[model samples]
Target: MKNFIHTFHKKLQLLAAILILSGVLVSFTYEINTSPDPKKDKVLVGVLRYILKNGHYEPKDVNDDFSKAVYTKFIDEMDPVKRYFIKSDIEEFSQYKYKIDDQLKREDLSFYNLVMERFYQRLEESSTYYKEILAQPFDFEKKEQIKMNYDELDFAKNKNELIDSWRKQMKFNVLNRIQVQLEIEEDKVKEDSTYVKRDFATIEIEAREKTLENINDFYERITELDHTDWFSTFVNCMVEQFDPHTTYFAPRIKEQFDINISGKIEGIGARLQEKNDYTKIVELISGGPAWKQGDLEVGDIILKVAQKDEEPVDIVGMRLDDAIKLIKGKKGTEVILTVKKVDNSIQKITIVRDVVELEETFVKSSIAIKDGKKYGIINLPKFYIDFENPDGRNSGSDMEKEIEALKKENIEGLLIDLRNNGGGSLKTAIEIGGLFIDKGPIVQVKYRGNSPSVKKDTDSDMQWDGSLVILVNELSASASEILAAAMQDYKRAVIIGSNQTYGKGTVQNVIPLNKYYNYPDDLGAVKLTIQKFYRINGGSTQLEGVHSDIAMPDKYSYVEIGERDLKNPLAWDKIEKANYEEMDFYKNFDQVVNTSKERISNSEEFTKINEYAIWLKQAQENNSFSLNFEKYIEEEKEHQAEIDRFKDVFKHESNLEFQSPLKELDLVKKDSSLAAKREAWHKNLKKDIYIDEALKVLSELEPKNNKLLAKK
Candidate 1:
């Protein structure tokens, strides 16, 4: 009895310790809010938060700043242009400005629900504003301007103020239409003296009708978006605070993302992006309907899309996915796009939708004889791989075969063009890097809570040992940087292009959240940034991609397209340099690089490129546009003249004929797409000044004996 009494105090202390730990654990766990949708979506919020907090490579604390960031991003996603929501609404939402992290920790979405509910109410109010304004015709003779860059403007003060903002915006939209219609009617008058031309009143009426139709489609599209669509915005807003590339893809959206990454789609293959409320073509899928037709071009603003025999639906100010839904359809169906060309001329282009296989994404090569020395140019669009099949066609293997074919042709030098390659499998990157360098470390990867590991090219046999040069652009990313940096580090290849690559070095793994829960339906997936990659020389590419060995002026040299411009991008870092050995680089590497830079400095084309880049930078900076029709027309003509002047600079064609890789002769004969795309590619190469300069650099890289044979 005496011994038991002595230990009673010890037992009491132990009990207190257990209770404190339990309370801490419970406090950190999430709790569901009272809203019906929150009750349903609480699981996603919890899972996404847990993954980001735990698995993310550079996780931020769930603190006041993070909560503030979420609030700001969520509001921006809802209304990017400040046309909706007043300053009062923002202040009201600020109550949860510091409490969002608390709500997230408690698994509550009271703030989200309140803000979104108010957003819908504002949406309803704004819909009336557009309709009321469009009912009356816009006065084109009025001298006014609309701020095209919404980021530079502040939100409205109240509902009436919001209506006035919408009035100006709607007036501007109608003015654009009236001006185009007036130009068309004027052109028709030139064709025939008696051609009955519509008057200004009729033109104005038509513009109003078009504007009303566009707004109607917009409202209808919003109606189609359910809770899932809204929730995606909230979820992504949370994840994106970690990094720009980190994202949360909802179920259907994930399917589309997978299709995009797979490099295949069953629709009219044209990539689109929203810039200043207009959907512009970012690029075209080669061998796809858009590329084959060649009517829709880069920088073309798609104003509307229509099915066969149906009235065109205006896509202006519409969300990207909604416009994509209208444009994408079953294979063999036709979709017509009403596009405003870069010259500000409007036209309709028809592209028959087809199953765009993205054959161009695969490694394609050609034999180019420059200075009489045979050189091989291999264009790798991306580091593509069939993840489902281990032995399937992948960049690494396809590249090996292409190199072998080029070697068989007795090529003396090689140009591995990775320009615009946004990267894929790390395994393929390693394998491809091995082709040039001997067995050595290619890249280093760092994960949270673990020592950085070195990924290597273990192959002892060398593949392409010739003098090499790699082409890159600002669009080149991830695995592309890995290969380029490795080659640069080993001095195995000369890197050229934009000032730097896209600077995306973080690695993401898309984990389907549904896999972690016992829930019945799909819960979508979280693209978690779990690791970062570094060059073998210890430099990370997080925000400073791989710097080019020979920096050249390109379109994006003065543009802010790199990762450093993105929101909350991960910080660049370094680790100990990985073990590697240098390859036998070109003996005259320094001489060649120096000569090339000197030539580019003196060339008229380079001068024009630099001038055009300056003009582009200025144009990007000036976002306010006049609503006056005459002034707008005058501005368009000025821009067209400026763009046309640069045409001659980019128009210098090289007399280089490229042949199919020797091993692909039979395949090229059998595959019409293969033959067609290569022919098209070779034709462009003939017109490529960059490739022409690259060839000249290759000539200088060759030794005297090699140069003499090349000269012959």
Candidate 2:
């Protein structure tokens, strides 16, 4: 057994912590050796416990309360919809509710064993129930309602009750599909005078059959999960008690987490998912080798995979992860895939594997021209970076290049869209924020009991000092919050969008499990919350994230989707404010904000969005649907009518023209896929009401030409 002890250098500490903390812990690892291994699970539990208790920012006591929380989380996760386990099964499992804490200290697996064995039995029975229910016809005339809120529902009292629940759920599913099919038929008949539409009976039967296939495929995928996968879930349930961000990654999951943080992977760059007994291609990375080949496409099913000049191995009935192993290879290596095309034709497509950078994950800039003044819009998906390779492509460097390109275009203003960016590399956030201002403190970091350390922009150079506006939403978090907060604190940029960003202010560090224990099996690492983030203004973006300078109404405005909505998030606090000089570039920032507010108040589009937000909130709360076909269709018709009122939100187009930079124009023109993506992005920007308002705000500021300071 090789010991994998990962020691972080002093300079790489901040980078490593942010890379793991910013993103969600990814999927489970592929099991190469699929035999029952209880010993590995036991060791993992011990190692995970040790790491959390010692390394966590706020470690909870492993007492009765902790045990109860874990017990509930584990069971809820395993049977979220209350479809598998019954009331009696939960009753039997409740005995370990308090014993789990003691079991963890002793590295006991009794609770996990009992639950898994019961779960498997229940899973098998549920599969049988679904198959039986779907095999027969469903009565659409049945006057009943299925509660969509699964949390409020209870487990079945008996076998018969469970079967009844499955029947009702299955009927609801079939009814939805039938309604959709009927709509398609109605549209087809209107579009073509001679088009023959399917009858009610035919549509109902087809919907049931499709529902059966979907359920069967779902069960097939579920059956592929082994012990390691479930154990990871159980471990995470325990670890999450420390905080929501702290999670466990299985060995393969850890590898994937690294790939996500880096924003690039070496493979064919095609995302695959299992469909019953086949591997279905879901998406092709825009600039990947598979996309460049032009032979492969989405919806293609891989029947077999082969190495260069080698006989193809059938991949039918193979696990998705296993099939991925066969498809992915080193850069410049060839992998031949015998795929069934969407047109039902079979063809062998050979693609040379190469490092595929996910285009959307990196920083991409587009220029919007209005009144002959160019404005730059840089959308940063995440604070991505490759921790293992210091010289690898990162968001910091990419943003720098993008700013330079936009500067060459002589943009009058800039809009940095950090909305929905959940953050990644901490180093990149600092690097990117520095581009907007001269050397100053950007954010503050503090350990559990240590003095707050100020993280600053040591560089004296500024890449962009024009009229800047940051776009954020409730989904923007961590490094996104850091950058926006710094800009807001310095009064260098106008923060616009949601009322407040996603309040994830904690910092986490990934600790490899194999480092502490030399084991043959590749035990995954744990992302532990080791620190908290504080803005330069002293307020921590924990439960209360960076408040927007000009709040806008959107679909998610009334949603509880921030850190405060999450379980056991760290509390918000304040520290000593960092010493930084506020920029006076936008002297009338308040005037610009007031003008935008007035415009928004009078705009019909903003009024519609606000009304839609209220409607969405009501829709989310009303979680019951009628099982009766007539009643269901009636309810859906009302919803469709309400949705129609907001159609202009999606269809609204602005007069501003958007296009790629001069340097990217040639590259995009060469890569048709790239061109299509940019074109789509430009079209969306043209329809963005927020961008239109932002451009107006930019024009109002009329920043001086000498906002850029002299480089030291």
Candidate 3:
């Protein structure tokens, strides 16, 4: 069971084809404002309509069904929790539910204007309701419950009903805080017999005050968002019907995307997300200052950020963009963060900002020893490439280099891990796949109304002709899926892990609004899906990602995940197969798969993992909780017990030993941070049951050719 307060941060990385827009220019006028600009909105509608009909891989018909989807999505996006809008409000807005398509065609803003005005009025009124509710103390003795099953809930019938709903939600918040505080007090009393505990009434009042402060902070963030931001949401509701990945980025957001693509920012190199009222650290770029500092970690909450010798700015409920701006600065500068650690302890961490290099995103290799035989394990985080510079570093070259080093180590087999890779450059994927097999068609691409074009790896230099294994999960997508599909088709490698990889076969191109229009102000752009990918063997990975040769039970095994789970994802289809030769290297591939299946089934750890995944899904589906403090605490304790039982899933250690390649070892010595990171990685590898299973499989495989060993 997951806590509502400390949930994991999820990052969405798009796999796109960045192309230059040239040749044609459609004229348009632009306007900018903190409020809604009818002229600008009309222009955006016209441009998006033209692009969707012309450029999108598959465009939905602009009918009543489409209009209804947009209407529902826009309302849900505005008031997700059913807190702001009332039944009457929805009733009044339902008149235009089937007219949005007509309005879009006519460049009309009547429905949009009506909704925006009512939304603003309701938003202001909500502040008063929350303030009034918080001014009075809640009755904890009342035996009541709050149902957070938002989808099943109906809007409030009247103003009185809406106020009561807010009251219950506020009560729930305060109750959770009070329960936590009481637990801390009880723990203190257990440690020290003489420690006097505070009275329940005093603790209850304090919780109310704290909850009020948090609510105010939430409202402060709301105030920062203007009409333009809301309009962007409305636009996205329409665009997302085409596909999940296709989105409308506002001018400010587009600028940030450009900055990220260039990868030249100087910061602490930690990816963060706005988790409710706090900023949560999601990922730390390897070899970065934050990774080196060792104090910051994933799941840590940033409460405040302060520069060197400056007063700390409490960032709770702050806008993510604003929080990021404060965190980022020039290289060599120091930023101090007051963070709430995973253990609930607050501490200040100081990190000197530096250029977060693309070093960590490259390929990393390690040598594993099993039964006196050496094997190579390479972990590729993404299929990265420098788009602006041809000579800059990329994953393909780094992969080839790692393989050559591994070949020198006299490794008998090789394994590549692409577990959570979300994909990047398609060119890099093709190049890397070429290193595994002789020249062949790697993948097929098809644009709208065009025949499938094969993307071939013409190079015939097979880098490692040894036994090969690739590990993937539901998170491995796009370019990662391409390489895995190519290898599986050619029988070059055994794919293992989840049932299927992340099914992201579509290619998107960001079309800038200003590029096609004569606009005075930057009008942002739309990321339009223009192409689809197909395997060399004639299957599309659109929804049915590459099937694994040997499936394994994982934490996400039973969860709704991948492209198939997304709304309005392009359907899976097949095309004509590209001619290719399947390798004749490994012996009894079916027997190998059967052997692994038997082992996985008999293993206690794998059984426990599958059981835990089932239980976690059930827990996620449950959203009701008692407001009564006693029952609430009891429920929390039961959940915590279940969580504790599964802790060993990650804690179990293996006997296999892992070490860095010779060249990386030398580089590690010169960089202490890199050394520490590699040491931690090797330690984790020692505990990896999956890696242990992979090593066993690697040891059993028989290769037809020994060219790599012979060269060594």
Cα-based lDDT for every prediction: 0.78, 0.79, 0.81
* TM-scores of the candidates in the order shown: 0.88, 0.78, 0.87
Query: Per-residue lDDT of 614-663 in model 1, one digit per residue for the tens?
Result: 77677677778888666777787787687677766566777877777777
- Candidate 2, residue 391: Cα displacement in angstroms equals 5.7
TM-score of 2: 0.78
> Which candidate achieves the best TM-score against the true structure?
1
Which lDDT tens digits does candidate 3 get at residues 1-712? 2332212111101101221112112121222223546688888888888888888999999999999999998888878788889999999999999999999999887777778778877877787787677666665556888998887899999999999999999898788768767777999999998999985555665666667766666666676677778888889899999999788889888888844332222499777765445687755666578876878876578988999999677687676777888999999999999897643445689999988766777789899988788999999988888889889889999899999999888999999999878788999999999998889999999999999999999998898899899999887889999999999999988899898988999999999988877777778899999999999999998999989988888877766668898889999999999998898777767678789989999999889988887886787677798886667878888877887787677566877888888978778989997887788888878988888887787777877776776676
**Model 1, runs deviating above 4 Å:** 1-37, 190-194, 255-265, 273-283, 293-301, 307-310, 330-334, 339-350, 665-674, 703-712
Could you tell me the TM-score of candidate 3? 0.87
Using lDDT as the measure, which candidate wins? 3
Cα RMSD (angstroms) for every candidate in the order listed: 16.7, 13.8, 10.0
Candidate achieving higher TM-score, 1 or 2: 1
Worst 10 residues of 2 by lDDT: 1-10
Instruction: Report clashes for each candidate as comma-separated counts.
Output: 4, 0, 0
